[model samples]
Target: MKRLEGRVAVVTGGASGIGFASVERLAAEGARVVITDLNEATGKAAVQRMADAGHAEAVDLVCGDVADEAHVADAMDRAIDRWGRLDIAFLNAGVGGAFGSLLETAVEDWDQTFAYLTRSVFLGIKHAGKRMGEGGSIIATASIAGLGGGAGSHGYSAAKAAVISLTRTAAMELGPRRIRVNAIAPGVISTPLAHRGKESNLEALCARQPWPDTGQPADIAAALAFLASDDARFVTGETVTVDGGLRARSSDVLGDNSMLLAGRTGMNRGSTGLKSGFRNTDR
Candidate 1:
């Protein structure tokens, strides 16, 4: 049987990038999907694309800002109005917000960052959780930046970290109802949010990765599908990192040979009270 058969899902930011990819994947997996986004034109085009692909019966569109609580409620209401129930909520809308040093960051930018990324997820869970039944999954788009530094900009990282923390707390509260709450911490994917400038080179970005392959939006969509499906029934309050090994190696491991000297001198001790060691094996 198809994984999401008879399911009804609402995906915010469903016009493009990871959100659009999730919308497509969920619909293709036998769920009736409602795609919500800020751009009505793009949202309509996305639905048209689905219709052209013969998924017309499986998809719908709602145009609104995800950060707005009223809009969020309306989206969920529309999903239930058409499908009779809500089973999955993918609160994936976000903005890059503040991108520079924290010292230079303005308070307004910080507020906007959380309003867009963190608050949107909070509202999604609040409204979606109320309408969900025995089996429901709520997934949010976090970032590797939320896990640590050097992965994202200042306000964006903080907002995503809040998303992760909120997911854990929400899962604990919603566990009794058989509803699952989870977050996806994606690495540097080739999306408009990842590379800012219109002239940015995605190929160059991919070459810098440990695996040398840029993560596609589809990779994240596939992960979201898994978490939304019964396959992840036992998983909740957890973050599934899809970072392509970016977080696996520390700066010491990826840095110069000075780490080797520090290791020998006992100056490279980590928080675990063990000296960092590097080994090269000729296989």
Candidate 2:
């Protein structure tokens, strides 16, 4: 039997990137999923694509902002209403965030950053944790930037650090109920958000990482499925580093990582909570 044959899942930001990949991975592993994203059209198309791929009866979509409590709750409810129970929640929606020095970052941008990255995870945990039964798995998308300095912009790094904390705290409260909470920290992934719309440039940078192969969405999806499956039943409150060995080396091993974008003032906030696409968002 597939690891998640009888499970039901909710994945936020399911229209693209790691979120979309996780939806497919979980379904392929025999789990029925309810997907949520900011863009209605793209999100529906993704569901339809999966349906065409033979998971027609195994997937559904809900279009809305991930940071909204109502949407998060609704996504969880959709899973239970459709499949009878919620076994996994992948709170993996995020955007390129306030990418500037702390002093240069605006307060509004900072709040918005947390709202999109951290608040969404909090809502997912609150709503999904309540609906989940024993042996449920809740995974959030964190980043190596949260692990230490020199890896991300000021606001983005802080927001991700908060996610890591949330994962641990949620695990403690949900553990006794047999629910596992975990986070995955990906490195310089070859994604639209990471590349800032320059796929070729991002691919080249990813290749330069300590790991020879560039990090892909599927790499993180594989890890997410592991955490979601019974195999990780014994694991909880941990952040799995999926950045290959990039974090293994010192941050300055290849010159200061921060210097790569130092002094470049353009922030790269995206429609992650607003939409899963990696396109730059003005708001």
Candidate 3:
């Protein structure tokens, strides 16, 4: 639709999953896309694939860690150098740490999670906002866990919560300049990060989803494209949830009339037919 024609976009973690999908969508919509990833080979190959697919001059790949200031700066530099101006920044680079409770989680692990998920957002907003000045959009990839208490990987939940707050503050600060900032909280997307489920009980996980099927990276990517485009020009400081009705479902589920009757009599602790809820797999 050429909604972003002549625009320059920087998508962090663009080598795979939602980030990669967003890069492809942006390029398809006529934006000059610069994909940044820590994996040099995959990043270059992704750009090449896009080029081969007829987006030859619209894509570039930069390799660097999103948490590094110099790397983030270099990515921004590359986007501006190639396209002359920056219009969109998708700070989607993040990692999901091992599942563990807060008390059992190591301090270093917490630090690393915050570094990539939270501090990296800070760096992205700082540099991208500075370069954009006005008429730009910054979207962060948060998770639904940010909205509530988490059971596994406490650090990730906390970092995502911080990302939401960061988005709000950045929006307030940049609104005067007409630069919008927002976040997307995806539920359970089937991405490389979610592949950890294959090693576990996949059946049980599938049963827990409100929808029959799991979400795809492209779902989140499409949301990103809309947010980055002028379609969301008036949207800012918001977190749009992309869950498959999982978050809105009721937690209580009765197995049979016997269980319901038992619950009325206080015979069970409202747990006779309960099962372990699905874990947060968004990264």
Candidate 4:
């Protein structure tokens, strides 16, 4: 039998990239999943694709903004209603957040950044905790940028740091209920959210990592699967770094004030037309 044979999962931002890879991984492990994304078309297409790849009955799609209180709450509720139980909740929906220099960042950009990157995680934990049973696992997507400087923009880094904090605190509160909360701090993954179609630059920048290979969405998905399964039953409130040594060394795109562009501040572009998620925003 598969590791997660009888489990049920909900993955936000499940339309593509890391999110889609995670959804596929979880489903392959035998978990029935409800996919949530801002774009209904993209979400449905993804469900169809996953179904075609086998496990046709194991995946479903739900569309909503992750930051909205109503949408987030309902997403969790619907998963339980459909699957009869919720075992894993991957609160991975996010945008690159407000990019560019801190000084030039707009107030609206900062607010929206938190809305997508931070608030959504909080809502996922809140609703999922309420609905999850013992042995449940909750995972959030954090960033290496949250751990240190230069890698991400001002607002994006701040928001991810908030996510890491939220995970620790939530894990403490939910431990008694047997629900585990944790965050993954990914570095330089080769996703639509990372390269933004700069395939040339993508390979060049990502391969600069100490590991030499570009971090892929499947790599993160594998870690996420472990956390969601019984394999990580004893782990909670930890921020697992999956950056391929990106954090151990200096970053070229990190805002060092040397290559910092002035007056060009906005949310980075993304695959969903949400905050552009290609977070290497110095360009």
86-110 in candidate 4: lDDT tens per residue? 8899999888767676666778889
lDDT of 1 by residue, 1-283 (tens): 8899999999998888898899889988999999998877778888999999899999988888778999999999999999899999999988766544454445766686788889999999999999997779999999987887556566777889999999999999999999999999997787765553442545553554588778989999999999999999999999999978877777332223221223221111111112233233221
lDDT of each: 0.81, 0.83, 0.77, 0.85
**If ranked by lDDT, best first, what sequence of candidates would result?**
4, 2, 1, 3
Question: Between which residue pairs do clashes occur in model 3?
Answer: none
Q: For model 2, where is the 10-residue window of minimal lDDT?
A: 273-282
Candidate 4 lands at a TM-score of 0.93
Please provide, for model 2 over 34-75, each residue's C-alpha lDDT reduced to its tens digit, 9 standing for 90 to 100: 999887777888898898899999999988888889988889
Residue 159's lDDT within candidate 3 is 87
Q: Write down the TM-score of every candidate.
A: 0.86, 0.91, 0.85, 0.93
Between prediction 2 and prediction 4, the one with superior lDDT is: 4
Q: If candidate 1 were superposed on the true structure by all CA atoms, what would the RMSD be?
A: 11.2
Stretches > 4 Å off in candidate 1 = 197-200, 203-205, 251-283
TM-score of 1: 0.86
Off by over 4 Å in 2: 253-267, 271-283
Instruction: Report per-prediction Cα RMSD to one decimal.
Output: 11.2, 3.5, 9.4, 3.0
**In model 4, what lDDT does residue 80 have?**
80
